[model samples]
Target: MGSATVLTSSWFCVLAVLAVLGDAFLPFLPSGTLVVLAVLKTKETADAPFLLGLAVACASFLGDVLLLSLARRGAPFLRRRLARSPKTAASVRRVQRALENRTNRAAATVVIVARFVPGGRTVLDLAMGHLPERSRRFLHWSAVSAAVWAGYIVTLGWLNSHWFNTTWLSLAVSCAAATAISAAVARLVRRSRQLSVVAQLDEPVEAVEAA
Candidate 1:
């Protein structure tokens, strides 16, 4: 690939990194869509697509780590800030429990499967980071997840590029996919909250014997 082509090739990786970073601080960012479009544009070029994939993977992994670490570290401050409110604590506990139940193997499966599942990929790493497992083990799983995500998107793009001539279409489809994935995540959150409520209801309350 020529210099221009190489630069074009790298554009996807850059955008993917930005998506990861953006999603890190802002949960509403369309990270999944951006990653797909980026891969779609870069997959067919003579440029070194593998290099671009590597860059994207690294960026995503690091971004996830940063987000999770910050959240964990900032929890104390957040707890202090929301001290008077038990609601926030309950919500945090629910999120923590959901993430904790996802074992290393389950996380690996999620990372690979969510590559095409939009918001799922971004949340996977964040959830993984909150696990009680060793940091080294988490890193290993995260790296593998990133690589799998990149490879899946890149390969899909390469296959579709033959029939899809416009990058705009790729972006449009990615957006739609992201929207659907967001809906799915919303449903999952709702269900988790309901489950938490049910679990709480199962507890017994103490009573006084005499008044």
Candidate 2:
């Protein structure tokens, strides 16, 4: 209702878009923190959080598309660089194989889940871009992931506001919580991959034993 609040909300939304978009390429940028700050700033403004969330989501989706396009255009060079690093190359190949083997639904699930894990989004996007056939599907799922991520992050900030009196405290607590969640998701993903590998290894042994 106030002019000051409106101006603050507008400025926060603009910063949120830049932070979210820039963080896609510059991993060091604290985009999540900025989102939380935005939530804190706009908490009193009617419908501000919804609009901010939508803006952040669109920015994230656009950033992902741009990153994927860059990766696709530089695929040959990226492949050559990866090839020089055997371990990294092998890891990328495994991800490609997994994507190729999975159903569209399952692969989309992976894309959605990867958005929660720190750094996972970048890696997966780059890997998906390297596979030209998979790029279109990646875009579709990226949009879903972006919206989900934006909502979840905004909710976290809003929830923190209920418990904390100060903006700095709310931002700090929310960011810490986000980091913890991301770490947990990364751990779960690693465990799932390990279990999958173990299952694959067991298949050959089971066949040998039966024969």
Candidate 3:
């Protein structure tokens, strides 16, 4: 209720929003880092409810929506900025194939996990837009992805808070964990691209052998 608490929450909410929005296009940004920081700050204030996670999740969802809107308009500036290799393009096909199913479960899983994978979310979102899923379908999946991603990041910070009383130490550890995950994701994306190329190379050989 104090002015100090009000000021802190206000600034944190704004930062969280900005970070999420930035991450939608620019995967390298530390939006997850900012969300963890906000969680730590929220813990420091007793009166505030446990609304930090929900707020961050909502911000993340909105960011994806913004990108989706732009993409629908034929402005694929961000997607174009991403690496255009065989694997990255394959990644797009993977998403399209995932969404091709009538059921939403596979598509939902890809969307949610892509948030954790560095550079994956942008690729998936663009795929969804380009593949031209109904706006309603994309929004529904986006909500699910954002909620899961934000909750995971928020939980990491919250758990760390209990372990280290020092705010700086806790924030550093959480951020480090987030960074490690991102690195792993980047590696995974690379591996996926490699596999896709292998698969493509094998297809013609298999057809020749059969014929």
Candidate 4:
């Protein structure tokens, strides 16, 4: 089918929404790839990209909100489980402390950054429910994160479409590139967390030495 015909169809819209929404709950879902594929097919139409981006963004935001609400409702049970494991409880306490220490903007930035990290969105959203921040604040930042994520993926697909001749080639290249980027970001985040732990651990020793 032609780009316009495929992009304008009802099935496409439904599929796009489902892919984005499902990803919120199922981290393994290839929602980003599906979105990129959709954008790749929008080459012939001028308005298709905008409409698709908007729909994807709205669906993503809605999914985040729903996931957050579910997490909020289950927070008590989750807390109980976390408390049973000292390691897990400590990790939760650390995240809570970090979020509590940071300013609103910094915390929101963390939320936005988590959206791009593999499997980070689900974990972060769930943790936000138990964090000290209000739901309104999280929703606001999550909306921005959703929009940014949609735009980033859509733009990547659009650019790849112009760069490559074949749709499959564009999809493959873009997905590979996105995966590499996410891997690198995940590595950096892990490293940062380790360094923070090291610093925290050293603080007591340094204080003892000073005495």
Candidate 5:
């Protein structure tokens, strides 16, 4: 068999397994890069594996949205535990301020766009959990954002499949690299958002003391 055929078959199997198992069992699977690589490989592989990409994307989108919904329903339980830890409360407060701002609609837009931004989804999900119970606006924006994210990643993967060139070693390395990159991005965004909130939180306190 030609190398491309072997590569194509192997990628199809791997993508299928990841779709079925990875998100639930392995948090670090780099599903985004896997999709990207799968699409990239389709240039020379078997029959443009776009269906696999779509399935994975839809699964991921559903998982994210479901998790967010669960978090929202379970907020009171979370808040009790979170409220006990000063650090947790502080983080929650930051997220709350961001979500409750006069430009909150804008913040929801960020949350939605962040879903496609590699590392932004997890943090945004957590932040969404802490928004006021009555804030349906955040939920609407989040669902729209999540849908956009799913379509964008799947489309990118389909378009870029020709670049994936599915070697086992290459796939392994790409997954690792994507995970690292996304984690680093998430950490930085969280820190920046936290700092911005801290600054905002201190402002009113400072104003009150001055008065």
Candidate 6:
């Protein structure tokens, strides 16, 4: 690999970490787009695409743990802040129920799955801390979530690369795809929480809160 390629890859790697870090707490950011472009650049750069995924995943993991720590130390304040958004509020309710053993699903399953559903990660991470799960357990699940989420996102980018010849085009395609998936997941979760038969067995927490 040439020195210029190495330098460029380093810069991209740094940017990837920053974008991933931002996305951890602020899901609105286009971190997936940046990572997709970075992977596309790998064809001309010295860095391997998988390595970029690892860096992004580790940065994401740290961001999650950092947020979890903050929520753990300031549970009362964070809870009030998180409850302001309908999406986050719903996730918080679901997480709290699962963590309290009120739900049939396991807390770990909820935590791991929340990583993909934008805004869901923040709510569930906060819920875990609020429920006061062990630090060891939280970190373990956070790592798993980050790794799996990173793989899924990177795989999407890799697939896009095959369809587009240009980096920008591939990035645009991936971002659009990611946005669509995010919206669909959000809608599905919202509908299930409010309208599903399982949710009708008792008062739906999200529905009542929304009202």
Q: How well is each residue in 1-211 modelled by candidate 6, as lDDT tens digits?
A: 6888768867776887798886656666667777877787675543466788898889889888877787778755555655555555665666566567533234455556666665566665666667674556767878988998888888888888888888788888898898888666555655664323222112212211111
Error of 2 at 17 (Å): 1.4
**lDDT for model 2:** 0.74
lDDT winner: 2
Displacement of residue 193 (Cα, Å) in model 6 is 7.3
- Per-residue error for 85 in candidate 6, Å, reads 6.6
Question: Once superposed on the true structure, which residue ranges of model 4 sit more than 4 Å away at CA?
Answer: 1-4, 7-10, 75-94, 191-211
Candidate 5's TM-score reads 0.54
* TM-score result, candidate 1: 0.60
> lDDT by residue for model 5 over 1-211, one digit each (tens)?
5887767757664674364233422334556666655655554545545555546655655655554565578656444554554554454456565656637555654655455344344444545665656246655665576456445554655543334555554555555655565455445544665334322222111000000
TM-scores for every candidate against the unseen true structure: 0.60, 0.81, 0.73, 0.77, 0.54, 0.75
Instruction: Give a tens-digit lDDT track for model 4, residues 22-49.
Output: 7766667788888888887666767777
Preferred candidate (lDDT higher): 1 or 4? 4
Candidate 3's C-alpha runs over 4 A off are: 1-6, 47-49, 76-94, 97-103, 182-211
Between candidates 4 and 6, the one scoring higher on lDDT is 4
lDDT of 1 at 87: 46
lDDT for model 1 comes to 0.53
Badly placed stretches (over 4 Å) of model 2 are: 1-5, 75-91, 193-211
Output the lDDT of residue 166, model 3.
95
lDDT of candidates 1 onward, in order: 0.53, 0.74, 0.66, 0.69, 0.50, 0.67
**Alpha carbon lDDT at 77, candidate 5:** 46
Model 4: ten consecutive residues of lowest lDDT: 202-211
Query: Weakest 10 consecutive residues, lDDT, candidate 3?
Result: 202-211
